[model samples]
Target: MRLLPWTGAGGKPCYLSTDDPHSPLSRLADDIEALHLADAAGVLEGARAVLDDPGAGEHAVRFALARAVESLGDTLRVAVSRGECA
Candidate 1:
């Protein structure tokens, strides 16, 4: 059983049962995880630049914060999917 990155309609965790790591579902999950990680890296770079700039506006800060939260969630989901949680 492998946990999925996204939740169900009712906020329940989604799982896939597959012994083959190269299954279609597994590949899909890998692709999503890669995308999330890439997004997180970009967001972190942008956030750092925004924070370093004294003239940064409230809107830019808020956007960076929101993106950070999303990235965190995505990272956590990937961890859960890999059974990293105890």
Candidate 2:
């Protein structure tokens, strides 16, 4: 999965690309809301772990991707909570 975030320095919040962004969770945003939430959570958790742990052993590039994914999830949650997911 490839995630691009808007926040903090540079154009990305966290930098990591996934081999697959079409997970069941991502499908929620398109075909199912519930699945989207679950997938989004997965992305966020991955990002949060990297953010909280600098030496998490994740390569710099991968770490950045995780951060970006986390930020993207946060953005999505905000939008959903605001009833903008219609």
TM-score of each: 0.91, 0.35
**In every candidate, how many clashes are there?**
0, 12
The lowest-lDDT stretch of 10 consecutive residues in candidate 1 is 77-86
Number of the predicted model whose lDDT against the real structure is largest: 1
Worst 10 residues of 2 by lDDT: 1-10
Question: Residue 50 of candidate 1: its Cα lDDT?
Answer: 88
TM-score of decoy 1: 0.91
Cα deviation of 39 in candidate 2 (Å)?
A: 0.9
1-86 in candidate 1: lDDT tens per residue? 88887789899888889898899888988898899889889989999998998999999999989989889889888877778864
Could you report the Cα RMSD, in angstroms, for every candidate shown? 1.2, 11.7
Q: CA lDDT of 31 in candidate 2?
A: 47
